[model samples]
Target: MNKTKNNFIYNIITKDLKKCKHKKIYTRFPPEPNGYLHIGHAKSILLNFNIAKKFNGICNLRLDDTNPSKENKKYVNSIKYDIKWLGFKFYYDIYYTSQYFYLLYKFSIKLIKNGLAYIDELNKHQISKYKGNFNNLGKNSPYRKRSINENLIFFKKMKNGFFNNGKISLRAKINMLSPNILMRDPILYRIKFNKHYKTKYIWCIYPMYDFAHCLSDYIEKITHSLCTLEFQDNKILYDWFLNNLKIFNKPKQYEFSRLNIEYNVISKRKLSILIKKKIITGWDDPRIVTLSGLRNRGYTSNSILNFCNSIGVTRQNSLIKISFLENFIRKELNIKSQRLIAVLNPIKIIIENFNKIKEKILIPNHPQNKNMGKRKYVFSKEIYIDNKDFKEKKTNGYRGLTIGNKVKLRYSYIIKAKKIKKDKNGNIIYILCKYYKNRKKNNVNGIIHWISKLYSIPAIFFLYYNLFKISNPENKKNFIKYINKKSLVINRGFIEKNIKNINNFSYQFERKGYFCLNKNFKNNNIFYFNRIVKLKNII
Candidate 1:
C-alpha cells in the first residue's frame, strides 16, 4: 500500500475494486529504451508501483523497445536500475515490446483479412500531406482500396525485407475526416530495415506506437494503461486497434499531467541533446534531473517518494517550484544525516593562548536526535573555519569574528578574536584567537563550525546550482544558450577525520547545506563531496 496520502487515481482504483471490475488489478510502467529515466518518470513509477501495492495487485516493468533505431541494452539496464533504486520490484520478469512482435504481426494480418487495414506506398511527406491538421480535412490515400489478398501479400513482403525503408507502410482503414487528427487513417506499421537490439535482423517492419502499445497491454492482460497527457489524442487510435481486432480483457488507457519542475527541462529529447553536445557531463550529471542524476546527487529514495506524494496527481498541468523538492530533501536529511563540520572556504585560526595540544570533544551526530549517539571530534590549537566567518571590521549585525568580538564554537567553547596577520598584498593570512573552557549559551555573537586543520581530511567540493539560468529555458528558441555557466563550482575544503570510508553517507556541513561524498574520489587519498542543497535560501 502507498504509505503516503491517497490521490484521485487511488480513489478510482478503490471504486473499481468495489465493483469487481477486475479480478486483480495489474499495472505497468512502459518506457521506451532510448534515454535515461528522469525525475518526471519517477512520478509515474511511484504511481504505478504504489497503486499495485495498495490493491494487492501486480505491476510489471515493460520496456517499449519497438523502435530499434534509438533503443539499446544500455538504456534498458539503466531504466531497470533506476526503478529498482526507487525501491520497486516488478511482479513479473522485465518484459519488452519485442517479445510480442510476431504476435502483433499476426494481429495486423487478421486486421487486413477483415478489411480494416491496407498497405500504402506513400512516403512520410506524402502521408503527412494526406493526414491533415486540426483545422483541415484529410484526403484518402490512392492505395486505400486495395483488396485484402493484395494488401496481405504486400505486408508479408514488407515483413520479408523486400521493400526499402519508407517505401511502404500499413495504415488502419479509418475515417479520413475524423475530428481527431490522430484517428485519420493513422499508420499502423512502418518498414525500417535497421537491426533490432533484441531481434537482430529477423524483422524489417515494425508496429507503430499506437499499434504496439494497446495490443501490448491487451496481450499482457494489463488492467490500467496509464500515460502522460500527450497521449490523450492517441486514446481513440489505441481503442481503434483493440476494437478492430476484438481482443478480450481489453486494457483501458488513462492520461495524467506529467511532472514539470521549474528551472529544469525533463524532456528526454532535450536531455539527450545536452549529453550528445557535451554541454553536461552525461545522463547521470548531478545537475541533470534524471533518476540516476538525482541518486548520484544524494537524493534519498524516501525523500523522492514523499515528494511525489506531496505533489499529488492531477489532470491539469502546471509547473512546480524546485525548492519544494529541496525542502523535502532538507527535512529528510536533517533527521537522517550526521552533523559534521566542513569548511569549503577555510581561513586558518590559531588559538594563541591554548596549551598547543590536541583536545577531544564528543558531539552528537544529530543535535535533535540524541539516540544517534556521538562521535569524537579533535579540537586543536590550529583550526580552520569558513573564510566567510571572519570580517576585517565589524558590521551592524555581523555574526562572525571582528577585532575584540567573542563568538561560540559549535559543541565546544567560546572564542575571542585577539589579532589578525596579513602578507604583502594585504590579504589576511590568519586570525589569532583565544578559546575559553566554558560553553556559552547566551553569547549574542553567532556560533561557528570548525575542524582541526592538522587532523582534518582534505577534500574537493562540487557545488551545484540550476542547470539553466532561466526558469523556463525550454520556452526559448535555443535552451542551450541559457545554460548556467556557473552551475558547478569546485572548492577545496576540510572535513572531520572520523568520516573516513563512509562515502555512502550524507552529512550536514554545519552552517552550509547537506553534502554527500563523491564516489569517484573514494580511491584517491583526498575526499570529494557534492553539495546537495544549502542549509537555507541565502537571500
Candidate 2:
C-alpha cells in the first residue's frame, strides 16, 4: 500500500478489482503443519498477506491438515508463532481443512451419485501401473464400471472403517488417456486409520489434498488461491472438483515459482532427516534458513520481507545466491544494532608504562545515532586483543602488531609492540607494549579493538558455516555424506561485561561480525552467542 511494486500477481489482482471480478480481495496461506516453515514458505506468506494489504482486503491463516499422520499440535502452534513474528495477522479465527471433513464427504457422495467418481478395487501398485507415465496411455481400472449405488455403499464402508489402509481408494472418473497425468483419474479419497489431531477417529476415509484444497478455498470464499508452480498441472484438477461439485463463487488459483536458495535445501523431508539424525542441532539451527532458525539467528522480520520483495515474484524457477539474503540481514543490523567489542581468539597485551588502574572509556553505542547514547567500558593496564591482530614476525605492508610495529588501540591509544613472551613451545603467550600518548608525532598504521582482560566476561561463541559441502546436497544420492563436519565450531571468548545487561538486540563484534545470544540456552549463568553473519559488502 505504501508504493505499488511491479509484480505480475499484484498486477493481476489490481486488474481483477478494477473489473469488479471480486467485490473484495481475499487470500490465504495454507501450510500443512507437518514441519517448521522455511524461507521458501516465508515468501508465500509475504506474497499472500501483502497482496491482501495492498488491496485493502483480508488474508486468512488456514491449516491444510489433510494427513494427520505427519501433522501434530506442535507444528500447528509453531506455524502460528512464525506468522505473527513476521508482523502479519490473520483476518479471522484460524481454520482447518478438518473443519470441512463432513462437507467434503457430502461432495464426494454427490460425485458418486453423478457417476463422476467411483471406488477403485485396484491395489496401490496396480493403480500406478494403470495410471501410465508420460510415454504410455493409461488404462481404466476394472472397477471403474461399477454402478453409482454400489460405489456409494463401498465408500460408506470405507468411512465406517471396514477397509484397511490402502485396500481401496475413490478416484474421479476423468479421462484415463488424458495427456495431463494429474487429470487421469486422480484419487479423491484414501483410507487412513491414523487418528487425526483435530478430528480424532470421527472419520477414517479422508479426502486427498487435490480434492480438499479447492473446496476449502470455495467454502471460505477466498478470491485468490495462490500456489507454487509445481501445482500448475494440478490446476486442471483444482478446477475440475469445483466445477463437478457445482459450487458457486469458485476461487481462482495462480502459480508462481517457489523460492530456491543455493547451498541450502528447503525440502521438509530432507530437513526432517537432518533433525532425526542429530546432524544439525534442531529446526532452529542458525545454519539453516527455517523461519524459526532465522529468528533465533537474529534476523529481523523487516529484513526478510525486504529480501522477498527484492527477489520479485515470477513464474520462472531460479536459484538465488545465499548472499542475497545475508546482505539484507547485514544491512538491517548495521543500523539497528549497537557496536560492542569481543575477542574470539584472545592474546594478552600488557601496557608496560600504564599503571594497573581501571579507567572508564566512553564510546557511542551506535556510530551514527547519537540518540542510542554511549556506554562506559573499563580499560586497564592489561587487555585482550584478537590473536589474528598480531604476528611474531611482520609480513609485507602488515598494519597490525609485531616487533617495533605501532598500531592504535581503537578509541584509546597508539601503542608499539616491544617484545613477546613464549612458553616451552614456540607460541606467543603475551605481548609487551608501550603507549605513545603523542599521537600527532607517531605514524600509527591501523586501529584494532580490544577488551579489558580484567573486566571482560567469558562467553561461548558459535561460528557456523554451511551445513552441506555441496550446493545441491539434496540432489546427491547420500546427502548426509556431504554434511560439513566443521559446520559448527565453538570457541571460548570474552565480551564486555556490560553485554550481560544487553537485551534481545544484535551487537557487532568489531572486526569479527554481528552476533546475538542463542536464546535456547538453559545453563546457569553460562552464556552462548551465535555469529549471525560475517562482515562483508554484498551490495
Candidate 3:
C-alpha cells in the first residue's frame, strides 16, 4: 500500500494492525439488490474495498439478494458492473445469500430442535405489537412454547410453499423482556412465495437480511462486516444469530454513517417513484447520482473513487456538499479534457472587415497538456455568441459584447458589433461587427467564447440545472412538488470545426460547458454537452 497523505480510517486501521491485534483484514459490501446503486453506495464501496486493499487483505462482493419480492437479476448484474467500474477487484467467488438457503434452513431447524428458535404464528400487526421497546422490552409470543416436532412440521410445509406471505416466520427464541428489542425473538426467516431469481421455487421461505448477513460473513470468514449506522441497532441480534449458530470466526460488524447529499434524495423508493412519474429521465438522469447517471454526465471513475477517499470513513454522519464532487471531477478533467468552443444560446455576429477565413485554424487541445496535442477549428467572418452574452440593456458585471461594444474573439481578433438584426418576434437575430486586424494589442473585457458560423457541427448544448427546487425537503413529503420544471434547457448551437474531429465520448465546449458523444451520434452529430457546473458564478 502506498502510505502517502494519511487518510483518516486508514490511519486507524493501520494503527490497529500495527499492534498485531487482528489477522488479515477481510471486508465485504453486502448490498440488497433492490435498486440501482447510488453515490452513497460509492462511499460504502470505497470504504470496504480500500480497507481490504490497504491491509493486503480481501474484499467480497456479496449480494444480499434474499428478498425476491424486490430483488431481480437485472439489479444483481448492475451491482456487479458498478463495482467493477469503480476499480475494485474482489478475491474469492461472488457469494449470494440464496447460496446459503439450504444451510440456513438446516441451521434454523437445528435451532428449533435445540429450543433456541420457534415458528411465530402471529400476524404482522401482532408481531409488531409484541416486538417491544429499547428500554421496556417485549411481550412474549403466545405460541413460543410449541414442541420442536410440531414447529418442524409447519416449517417444512412453509418450505414447500404451504403458507401465504407473512402468515408465518421462523424467529429466534431470544429474550422477550430484553432491553435490546432487536433480540426480542427477531424473525429469522419469512415466507415469500415469489420465485427467487437464483433459487427459483426450490424454497418458499427466505432468510431475513440480519440472519443471512452475519452468517454469510462467517461462512466467508470476513474479518469485518462493515455496515451503515442504521444497522448498529441490529447488532445485538447480529451477535445473537452468530452465537446461536456457533459459527467459527464470527465477523464483527462496524457501523459508519451512510453518505447524504444536498438537493438529492438517496432513497431507492423515492428514486423509483421519480422515474415512474417521469419526474426525471431515469435513475441515471444527470440530476440523480447513480453510477450510470454520473457516467452519462461525464464523471470519471477516478474522480468518484477519489471523492470517496477524500471523505474518508467515520462513524459520524457527513453532509457533503455537491461541490466536493464537482471539484474532483473538474480537477481530473482540467488535465485530461481539451478546451474547445461551443456557444449554447447563439446570436449571429459578423465581422464587417476581416480576413474571410473559412478553413481550419490549429488550436492546442488543452493548453497545459501538450501530449493532448492540437486540432484545427473553423474561424469565419460570421459566428454565434451566446444570446445571454449580449443584451439590449446592460448590467454591472456584464463583460460580454453587447451592441456597439468591442470584445476579443478567443485566439483571434478583437471586434465591435456596429449593428443588430431582429426577427418579427423582436428576438436579436444577427450582429454586424467590425474586426481590428493589427498584429494585436489585447482588447475587450474577455474573449467571450465564439463558435464558427462555417464548417458547422450540429451540436446540442445543455444548460443543465438541479432537478429539485428545495435543497433538502422534509422526509417522505411530496418532494416532487418541488421538482425544477426547467432542469434541462437545450440549445442548438455550433462549435469550431476542430471539434468535428473530436472523439465523441468526451470534449469540452470552452466557456460554454463539457460535452460527450451521444450513443446515437450520426455524421450530422447531435452533441449533448452538460454545463459542467457554471463558468465561475454565472448564477
> Which candidate should be chosen as best, given TM-score against the real structure?
2
RMSD of 2: 2.4
Q: Give the per-residue lDDT digits (tens) of candidate 1, residues 357-433.
A: 88888888888999988888888899998888899788988898777988888888788888899999988788999
For residues 1-539, what per-residue lDDT tens digits would candidate 2 score against the true structure? 22246588998998998899999988999999999999999999999998888899889999999997899999999999999998998888999999999999999999999999999989989999999999998999999999999999999999999999999999999999999989889999999999899988898988889999999999989999999999998888988888888887889999998898877878899999999999877888888989998888888888898888788788999988888899999998888888888988899999999885987888888889999999998878899988888987889877788888888888788889999999999787889999876655367767888999877988889887888888777577687888889888888878888887788478988888899988777554566888999899511
Clashing residue pairs found in predicted model 2: none
In order of appearance, the predictions have TM-scores of 0.92, 0.93, 0.91
lDDT (10s digit) by residue, model 3, range 20-102: 75788888888888888998899888888878876898888888988999999989888999999998877878889888888
Off by over 4 Å in 3: 1-23, 132-138, 176-179, 354-360, 370-373, 439-446, 473-478, 520-525, 532-535
Q: Which consecutive 10 residues in model 3 have the weakest lDDT in total?
A: 1-10
- Model 1: pairs clashing at backbone N, Cα or C within 3 Å: none
Q: Arrange candidates, best TM-score first.
A: 2, 1, 3
Q: Cα lDDT of all candidates, in order?
A: 0.87, 0.88, 0.78
Once superposed on the true structure, which residue ranges of model 2 sit more than 4 Å away at CA?
Answer: 1-3, 425-427, 472-478, 522-525, 537-539
For candidate 3, list the clashing residue pairs, or say none. Answer: 340-510, 504-517
